[model samples]
Target: MGVVVSLEDSKNRQASVKPLVDLTKGDMERVNQLILSKAGSDVQMIPEVANHLISSGGKRLRPMLTLASAAMFGYAGDSHIKLATSVEFMHTATLLHDDVVDESDLRRGKSTARTIWGNQASVLVGDFLLGQAFRMMVDVGSLDALDVLSTAASVIAEGEVLQLSVAKNMETTEDDYLQVIRAKTAALFAAAAEVGPIIAGASRAERNALKSYGMNLGLAFQLVDDVLDYGGSAAELGKNVGDDFREGKITLPVILSYRRGTPDERQFWRTAIEGGENGDENLEKALALITRYNGLGDTIARAQHYGTIARDALAPMPASALKSALLEVIDFCIERLN
Candidate 1:
């Protein structure tokens, strides 16, 4: 299908189904088993903390991406299961650290690792999980595997640093926002897709294709996440609405609102986010400003644009159910808000 048509299909599918693909049927069970096993036996305290988040039941999108990418390339070995589990371990480690850094109390509607275990314990266990992830990758026995994950780890740290530097700063540009998202989120997704072909010894073209697909999908996923923080129900989104604004983190919708708001709306932001505190009363005004400026529409459009790019990236791959599932995933990314 053409890129535009594929994008439309993704949109349509997203409206009907929350997820573009379901991983439960194939190697997903094996991958999950490996992930639990890799959490390690000794160091009961650390492993317990890691298990807390692991068992909380996230969407497990990263590992699913890894398996899907390998499947797309026609890999049948069990190594993909190990690698996918490793990807999930790395992802979980980051979240543990992220909650500590953000001083967050809630994740997936439960108390976060840091909240339950204290910051020091959460940080230490996060370190432990990161170590386990590398050890697992070493067991996988691919230098290419090391290259993808090590680079992604560095990028994730950079993204965290970038986010820390920009917090509560009104001078952040759209480019700044994109940099943070690429580092914090898109880098891992790209690695998840790229590693499959790297592991399976697929052609360079195929590797690049999967990489682009992953990057675009990651971007779309994050945009929707940011948008949902402003527009979603707390129950539906599994966190407090306006948490981004409350944390003084300006995401795409807020940035768009700041850029396009009327003079009064601009002044409201200057006081609420820049000069004054973001009070509960200001939330209505904030939402109104974004609505008036069409910030939500602009943000959603950007997400859809990335979803289109991701779907188009699948064209070079041979037709398979796995490839089709990946396309559906791109659709799910864009339609998640609805």
Candidate 2:
């Protein structure tokens, strides 16, 4: 496998989403309007909670992917707009539900909806958005799109359950963790990219290519998130650092550190992660150990592995502005470490 290119090796590697953003700007505006329209309701609190996350300055990358994938095929219709909006709603609902599950106090560097409106309100509003997303899918009149999205919803839930099962369990293996992230994170990305070509009536090979690209991109994205949780700041990650450790969630860093540490270091991790000794002091200790083991660096290397696959997934497609933008996005996902 090709290793991640160092920043020094990749000069002029503009690893930002600007090209894709610029290409999909007009469609994304419509998607945003639809998102606001669908998130509205007679119940005031529903919009309040929904809008909290919606307006929280997220990159809106998922919906943009839908738009880009469709436009790449020269799709000139309004259906992509609704589908893109539906994709955004699905993503927003997941965030609301995740905050409640993780008991997260913040999202996108702002207070989470659950913290302000309570977990019940957050979960209910998430459900409301999900219902609206399906309604939009139904409006599209494409059973294929519906099947892809609905199956993704089910798989995401299963991923969450699997993660919960492994929480605080030091025995979690690398393959086990990969399975959790694949379902929880990658499934939506795969669906979002696939449905675009599905609605555009693209060939099966074209659709499968985008799906594979999205799945590996999602894996790399989540692995970078794992690295950032320990090494990044609240502004960078949009959440408190060490939050995962406090929650006893066994991420890649913890798994690596635990597996490679001496017995005494392993015992310390057990005390910190399992025995609920995850205070600020322990968080400091955990950081030291993670650095000592180069866990953060190695996790980035793993993300690079998936990123390479994502790039290769695009190889069969003809080179174009859209293809170039999509390929650069893979670099952006991993090179965030730089």
Winning candidate number (lDDT): 2
Worst 10-residue lDDT window, candidate 2: 1-10
Residue-wise C-alpha lDDT for candidate 1, range 1-338, written one tens digit per residue: 00011123422234422232454346888877777787867878877898899999687888888888887777877778877787888899899988988888788778898877899999888888888888878888999878988999999999999999988676688999999999999999999888888888899898899999988889999998877777776764667777777777778988888887667777778788776577777877888777777777788889989989998898877877677777777766766643
Give residue 246's lDDT in candidate 2 (0 to 100).
92
* Backbone N/Cα/C clashes per model: 0, 0
TM-score of each: 0.92, 0.96
Residue 328 in model 2: lDDT: 83
Error of 2 at 221 (Å): 0.4
lDDT of 1: 0.80
Tell me the TM-score of model 1.
0.92
